[model samples]
Target: MRLSMDLELQDIPGQLLLALQPLKDNKANIISVVHHRERKTPRGTIPVRFVVEMDRSKLDAVKSQLVSLGVTVVRAGEVRFIEDVAVVLVGHILDSDLGDTINRIDSTGYAEVMDLALTMPGVNEPSSAYLRIRATGKAEIHKALSILRQVGEEKKLLVIEPIEDEAA
Candidate 1:
């Protein structure tokens, strides 16, 4: 099972290592760690967030071990991202460097291509691609779309952003 854990650690040397030791001991595979060293809690402790995968049976042990090590587990549960925007790219998706197009949006740090569907009839024909981008916020979604538009223009592809109005 995948778990998202939010921890509070002291803002001092070896604090991070001390918090991670329980995860190591419990055999949880670390996926991503967003260490917010500059952000402090009400008590002036650093906030750290992690996405980890571990056996369901071992989760309880890990949580216990972490608490024993003086690490405050603020929250722990299944990891999930809330924001998603669907976009369509029409025209020469394959010929126009699709990988680069996707990478451009992902490199922004606030958005990522979470899902994609491609349709290509032939090598000499234009193709269409549908992508679902997960972003951190509403503003970031617009920024990601702007990046997509810029990339699409550079590659001669058409970008269709999702909206309620058809004529806008």
Candidate 2:
């Protein structure tokens, strides 16, 4: 059976490894992991998404083991997150408290920032960033981008939203 779970882990070194150890102990084979270390949830916790393959009978045991390791399983079931969105933020990103902006978008539970890249030309020049976000569905992805745009506007930054393809 294929299972997807969302978990909350303490923001510390090796915490992710520690959380995964329980699954390994239970003989669960990890298919993929979407780990976001830069953003924290509203509860001040890092969220992790795990895709694992295991027998249905072992599902309960896996949950128990994860809980024993102080990991909070946010959601656990068969559904997978299949949507993704990317946006670019331009103009003085660093000076506007980039961390706070990222945290706000991540706090919305439905979406997470999967990657970020920042560029700065000089001390007085503007900084730009490319952010890749992942969400469970199209609606959630749009909501995340809207939140990010709001943040950028408040900080006097320019946001380049994703353009949809005409023939998709």
Candidate 3:
């Protein structure tokens, strides 16, 4: 299962190590860690957010480990992203560099291509691609679509966005 865990740590060194070691020992694959060291909580602690892929059953053990290590686990049972958008590209997708297109979304760190289907009828023919993009929220979905629009314009492809998402 995928989880997004929020933790509070002291302003001392090695606090991040404390937050990470439990996930590591519990065999959790750390996906992303957002450590706002410059920002302090009301309790004068640092707020750290972690996204990991781990077994659901081992959640309690990880939490217990963190608590024992003096780390506060604020929230820990959320999936990575909450919003998704589907888009269609109609043009010479392969020749226009598909990998870079996907990377544009993934590199944003706020959105990613969760699914893709491409159809190429002939070597010189235009192809059609269907992509499912997942983002953290509605604003992020718009941000991703903006990037996609720019990419489509640069590649001279037709970008079909959902009508519900076109209310900008």
Reference-based lDDT, residue 31, model 2: 64
| Model 2 TM-score on a 0 to 1 scale | 0.53
**Candidate 2: minimum summed lDDT over ten consecutive residues — where?**
30-39
Q: The CA-based lDDT of model 3 is what?
A: 0.87
Kindly report which residue pairs in candidate 1 clash with one another.
none
Per-residue CA lDDT of model 2 for 1-168, tens digit only, reads 767788999887888998888788778888657676656888888988876777768877878888988899988887455788889999988888998888887666556788999999998899889999887666567778888888988999999988976543
Best by lDDT: 3
Off by over 4 Å in 3: 80-93, 97-100, 103-110, 114-134, 137-168
Alpha carbon lDDT of each predicted model: 0.81, 0.81, 0.87
Off by over 4 Å in 2: 1-79, 166-168
- All candidates: TM-score: 0.62, 0.53, 0.60
Clash tally for model 3: 0
| Order of candidate numbers by TM-score, starting with the best | 1, 3, 2
lDDT per residue for candidate 3 within 1-168, as digits (tens), equals: 777787999999888987889898999988667777767898999988777889999999999999998999888886668899999999989888999999999877657999999999998888999999997666668889999999999999999999893555
Candidate with the larger TM-score of 2 and 3: 3
User: For this target, which candidate reaches the highest TM-score against the unseen true structure?
Assistant: 1
